[model samples]
Target chain A: MSEFTRGFRAGIPIGIGYLSVSFTFGIMAVSYGFSWWQAVIISMLTLTSAGQLAGISVMVHPGQYLEMLFSQLTINIRYSFMSVSLSQKVAASFSGMKRWLLGFFMTDEIFAVASAEKTVDAKFFFGLSVAPYFGWALGTLGGSVLGNILPEVLMNSLCLAIYGMFLAIIAPKARTSRAVLCVTVVAILLHVMFVYLPILNRVSSGIAVSVCAIVAALIGAWLFPHDEEENEA
Target chain B: MREFFIYLVILVGSTYLVRALPFALMRKKIKNRFIRSFLYYIPYTVLAAMTFPAAVLATGNMLAASLGLIAGGVLALQGKGLTLVAFVCCALSLMTDLIMITLN
Candidate 1:
């Protein structure tokens, strides 16, 4: 309701979710034989789950750094797309400093929540971001420090928590919008077909899904043009 | 130690390069229609790309992938969040693998 309340409600889940994901990353880093502080610093600076995960294999195999770099770039490049969408929501007069700072934290979840807001003020978005950032950094530190303390079964269970986190974000949006529903369904169907097709096996799953979703979205947008009313907030 | 620092420098530099440059230069409202269309579909494409291979294939078998898909799809249909559903389905699939491993 109130900005403070809304900020608090939105921030808590992000905080809890980041805590777990970051913890997993930290454990992964340590398991890969990186120093605890190296893991913590990576989590803090990158603030990206996938990037950090991929960083490990890269760290382990120095010769593969080039391939790792390209792969991470491919996976995380979508953030630039998120930033472009967020340009409208961000304050026109936000100081250059604020823009730089906010851009650093321009994550998928943050962009989703901020872009969907009724008011596109800079302060509110910053407030929402603070909790998740703190959670992620702390979680990495804690997990790395606590490495091997937990049973393998439990640790493995927590690792899968990430997929659940993704489902939570998309499902709600799909329920309200038939457009979203159709797009998600189409994407899933295409995913299955691509995965099963013998000819398409050469392509990585990431590339295949990216191609299918982009095609589906263009078709969806053409079929159902956005109304001015729906576009606002 | 020098190698580590070199790696760190490259990693940090490369990361900042990818993220910071666009924000600095792209102050103008993104007016290009083609660019706008590209941005609109990219997230969906990225999400689908990230989700299917990583989560679904992590299990190394069709049964686990199917279980994951069902779990993921059901949670997705019931209006759960992306992170939650992805995490649950992945966990379920992983647990299935662990059990199968133990049994075998």
Candidate 2:
């Protein structure tokens, strides 16, 4: 198969996964007083799950513009690090413009699959991203418009679906890897601690998550450093 | 309407700023051992933290959510793929929710 098709095929599963999460976001945005189109637009523009969710929360509650800015800054900061790591793996000869385009669609799921590749082909990158991008936008649109049509109970129950996706991503890794299990457990504990702690609880959710992830990973790295051959490979 | 538009622009701008800036700046390879190892462990750890606690709370049915998580965990340990794990978890949670509602 062509490189583009290969990437697109690889991304199809991510698109399916995004549908579940973005659908929830769509319903959430509308319930927060955003119109259907507005929710779709937000999904289109922000493209970050946590970032868009935080934006909706900001809009719902009257907040300073600066607070909203800071919130966005804090929420999406991890993406910068994720983007940087993926940059090294992307084709060295890829054009600057394509790089910019690729950067915009770099969600965690996309980054995970793309970064794991031996080499990121530009066409593959394009094909890989297109499905998830439109899938998210469409999912949001559907949720916004059709969310109300569902029974309240069903709507509430569907909330578990997104978490299911999250579980699927981590459970397998933790099962086989001792270091991963240790870090995962530590990360969960730190996250719970932060959310309950009086002072730290005030931290924006995005920043709180980043801090917890970094701290847990720090401990994991120190304790279980990768093999020497695996340093940069 | 106008205020909404303004915030949308600001929110979109800021989100993109952080996400894209690193890609723009880091054109070359990341050579630092510490940073590389750090990023390597991040996805699963961060995802683990984000999923748990929030997952249970999100369902609002702790009993059912816990059941789903345990089942999902077991399935994942058996080398189940993402689609299967998600499917089984959602189904378990849904069944639990249904059973509880019926009992009530």
Candidate 3:
């Protein structure tokens, strides 16, 4: 199979998974007094779940423009780390304008799948992006137009789907590698502490998540450094 | 409406820059062993951190969400594909919610 086609096929699950979350986002934007088209437009442009939801919250309030900018920056900062990491994985052909274009579509799920590959090129990355991109926009359109027609229980259940995808990405690797298993455990412990602890919990989730992931990965790297040859192989 | 459009611009610009700048600027791959390993572990750590505690709260009911998490984890460990794992989690969580509703 062609590389682009391979990537597109790999992305189908992510596209399906995005439908529920973006559907919720659409309903939310509409409820916040946005028109259906506005909701669709936001999804098309932002293409992020937490950032867009937070954006809507900020917009509905008497928030300043700086608040919108800072909130999005803070909430979406993890993408920077993911983007930097992914830069190492892309094929040499992906440079300049290609890199910039690829960055626009680098959602967490897409990043995970792309980084899993042996080598990623511009065509593969763009093809991988197509399904989730349209899934997000189309889901928003459906949600805004349909508006909570699905049962609440089903909606709540569907919210778990993304987390399910996350687990699918990590679990098999964790099962095979001791380093990965430790990193996963440490990250989860740190996350739980951040969520339940008093003052620490006050930190915004975006920052908290970034810190937890960084610290856990640091410990994992220090303890179980991989052979350079193994990584490239 | 114009104000909303301005806010949207700010939102899109900030978020896009966060994703773009690092990928664009970091043209050369780091050869450092530690940093490369760190990068290797980043996806797993980040995904794990994002999934837990948050996934517990995903379905509103902790019980149902936990069930979904277990189901997803087990299925994934068995080498199940992403689509199956995700849909099964949703279905399991929904069934748990429905069963609880019927009982209540």
Candidate 4:
């Protein structure tokens, strides 16, 4: 199968998982006094759940544009690390304008799936992006137009799909690799600390996630650095 | 409306720049063993960090969410596909929610 087709297939689950999350976002945005079209436009332009949700609050509260900029930069800073890591995985031919375009669609789930591949290229990146991008936008449209129709229980349940996908991505790798297992455990512990500790709990979720991932990965790297030759093979 | 548009621009610009600059600037692979390993382990670390307490609280009921997490984790470890794991997690969480409601 072609690489693009393969990537497209891989992205289908991520796209499906995005529907419920974005649906929630749409409902929230509309309830915040945004028109349905405005909510859809925000989803199309931003394509980030946390950032968009945070942005909606800022807009509704008469916050400054500078506040929006800082909030987005802080919340989305994790993408820089993900993007740099993905940059190394892409084929040499994946460059120039395509890099910019591909970067635009670099959501967390897309990064997870794309970085899992042996090699990423322009076709694969674009193909992987299509489903989730449209799923996000279309889901927003649906939710904005039909707010609160779905039962709250159903909505809450559907939110688990994305987390399930994350587990699916990490579980097998952690099972096989001692380094991955250690890193996963350490990251989870760090996240728990951030969520509950008095001073740490004040840290925004985005910054907490980035710090936990970096610290956990650094520890893993220090103790179990990859052998270049073994990795190539 | 114009103010909203400006806010949108700020949000899009800040977020997009962070994502784009890193990808666009880093054209060559790093040969450093430590950095390479760090990058290699990043996806696992990020996913794990994102999943834990967040997933536990996802369904608004810790019990139901935990059940879904365990079901998803076990299915994934058994080499289930992503779609199946996600589907089962959602279904299980919904069922747990229903049972909790009935009991209440």
TM-scores of all predicted structures: 0.73, 0.83, 0.77, 0.75
**After superposing candidate 3, which stretches have Cα over 4 Å from the reference?**
A1-14, A24-39, A48-94, A107-124, A144-147, A229-233, B1-11
Off by over 4 Å in 2: A54-59, A64-78, A196-207, A226-233, B1-7
Q: Residue A77 CA error for candidate 2 (Å)?
A: 4.5
State residue A92's C-alpha deviation in candidate 1, in Å.
4.6
Q: After superposition, how far is residue A75 of candidate 2 from its true place, in Å?
A: 5.2
Report model 3's TM-score to 2 decimal places.
0.77
Residue range with the least summed lDDT across 10 consecutive positions in model 1 chain A: A224-233
> Model 3, clash count?
0
- The candidate scoring highest on DockQ is 3
lDDT per residue (tens digit) for residues A98-199 in model 4: 898889998878887888778888898988998999989998998787766777787778667767777887898888888889999999999999999999
Predictions in order: chain A TM-score:
0.71, 0.80, 0.70, 0.69
Docking class of 4: medium
Which scores better on TM-score, 2 or 3?
2
* Alpha-carbon RMSD, candidate 1: 4.7
Ranking by lDDT: 3, 4, 2, 1
lDDT tens readout by residue for model 1, A15-90:
8778877887777677779888998878777777655665565667655455555655655666765665566556
Residue-level lDDT tens digits of model 3 in B1-104: 88888888898889899999999998665678897787678768877887888888867899998998898899999988767888888888899999999999
Candidate 2 C-alpha lDDT tens digits along A1-233: 99989989999988887887788788878777889999999999888776787678678755457767865765466687778767777777765777776678878778878877887878888889988998899999988888899876666656666666667667767876788889989999998988888998887665566678778888988888754433121
